[model samples]
Target: MEQPAASGPPNVAVRAAEKRGYAVSKEQPERPGRPTLDAGRSGGVTVVGDPPRRPHARQRISTTLDLIRANPTGRIALKIFIAIAGALVVTIGIALIPLPGPGWLLVIAGLGIWAVEFHWARRLLGFTRRHVHGWTQWVTRQSLPVRLVLGAVGLVFVATVVWLSLKYSLGIDVVAEVMHYLATH
Candidate 1:
């Protein structure tokens, strides 16, 4: 029998092909412990690796924002737009606070919108996020009975507020109306 023919490693052939500007795959193969610079979708250079140093969501957002704010005139315009939009959202959120709706959620969303342009808003958002997390943790630590009691108290408080708001603001007495309707029916 003839001796077996020697064959070069598959990777060596692939690497040679790569040097000749011929990529077998659309996605370039990533090697461990080495970083590679690749062209990004937006025509920017992106560094990728085994442990890829991809842009954070915030970084990407800021980058897009920065592009929009390259000139002083554009920057001022963006700032104004953000401020107006954020104010409107926050105002609506504040208005909805006393009503049964996503008041806090809208408020946080407004803060996020403001955070895109304002450092103060970013700091306040972080503070609010921390406090909310703390409150959630504290509530979770309470006993089931305590939690239920707290919930009931909250419900009572909300009902009382809603009733008072309706009675004073709109001259509508819901409880009396309900009683009258029930009695008649």
Candidate 2:
């Protein structure tokens, strides 16, 4: 007997299974070549979804790199330009590091900018990507309290560094200014 179709949000794999006259079950083990969300879930937890289909930036970068690589005569000039641009980006990133912004990301991006033309940069970028991915996974696996405490500690460290920098550079504490304003007002 044909059972009533499962009523819920549409899923690609479930639809496909229904089309093929196969019963769809939430607890059904994933079969090869099937896009099963249940396969990705463990103990009611999902690790990651599908990756992006296409990255525009990646396409642009590859196109630019291919153009540079094809022109053997202009290779040296291109390399020089790439190096200068990457160095400038890295310098700017370093300057922004203590200013509460995407400093490290910019630095990694600069390395990526260089990676297109430099083998060493490519290796370094891959290494950084791997380590960062592992670190992210490890952090995600930590208990909430542990994660919160680590975050608090990091915040305190950055605050302390910022305070010291402001005190040394401008001879005034921002906290003191805020306090003075509060007391006078």
Candidate 3:
């Protein structure tokens, strides 16, 4: 291609950008490293994604896990320890599930712990996360009244579980007590 006299690259750049379907502008080009609207569409916008993530603590385990994995016996020991820890947390969560607390949260936490070392657990955890995220998105998309009704339904479910747990585990029937009080009043 023949160079356009000595008119410089600015005009050529604008023509090139326009040809590429960019939102070209005549504004002065910003310095390197920082793009501007004149540069193109979505220029100058620093859209950072979610921070780097891991199911486990990276800093704490990075060096230690490598060191331990290097030894044959240590690998077995590590697996054993992880299994025991994950099982303990899950057991606690199962025991607490009937009560009013973070039982499900603990269960998921235990799964995350297992996921740190187990491929099966990682896949299961991912499945659980995707479903939960979908549920959240669905709920958010609903109307206000529908969302409120869903919240009320959740409250009722929790209340029933709490009542059942108290009655069965501690021999205390809170619902019956409240009913008796209401009758006397």
Candidate 4:
């Protein structure tokens, strides 16, 4: 019976040990109370745990606002161009909001464009965010019936505007004439 070679290369022995359910440590010393190879499980790999999550909304908003505010005296043409581009981005973003593509992100960009030109935009953005935040909290507290009624009221208001526009701008006479013709033949 020939004795097996003790070692050829370090990787060969380490791989063999790993296959047989053992870990080959790097140069670092193992921590006390930490299990080595066989005491835990068959795999040689170890998973390091996730870091703790931290809140970052304030940091992000401040950084973004600062970048926008930095160009206060930038060119008018550039500002207009940026606003148009941002509006297009926001339009596309709004369409994608219900599906994907980060609609809120485009809205922020649109606000940033307006913020570059107008104090009202800044105030409006602040008001919108505050109201939105409050409304979200309020909605969670409200009953379903209250939400449904509010939604219906909003829909009716929109429908009334549409109805009035069609009646006045497009003329009720044309509508009636079309209806009369349709009914006749």
lDDT of 1: 0.73
Alpha-carbon RMSD, each predicted model: 13.3, 15.7, 16.3, 16.1
C-alpha lDDT values of all predictions: 0.73, 0.70, 0.71, 0.59
Which residue runs of candidate 2 sit more than 4 Å off their true CA positions? 1-64, 178-185
lDDT by residue (4-102, candidate 3, tens digit) is: 132112455546555755543344323333322332424344422444233235533654564455456767898889889998998999888878798
- In TM-score terms, candidate 4 sits at 0.38
**What's the true lDDT of residue 61 in model 1?**
62
Return the TM-score for candidate 2, rounded to 2 decimals: 0.61
Better of 2 and 3 by lDDT: 3
What are the models' TM-scores?
0.66, 0.61, 0.66, 0.38
Per-residue lDDT of 14-87 in model 4, one digit per residue for the tens? 46555755444423234333333442644544333444233256544443343334344424555677678767
Residue 20 displacement (Å), model 1: 38
Rank by TM-score (best first): 1, 3, 2, 4
List of clashing residue pairs for candidate 3: none
Q: Which stretches of candidate 3 lie over 4 Å from their true place?
A: 1-60
Cα shift from native, residue 9, model 4 (Å): 48
Position 9, candidate 1: lDDT:
25
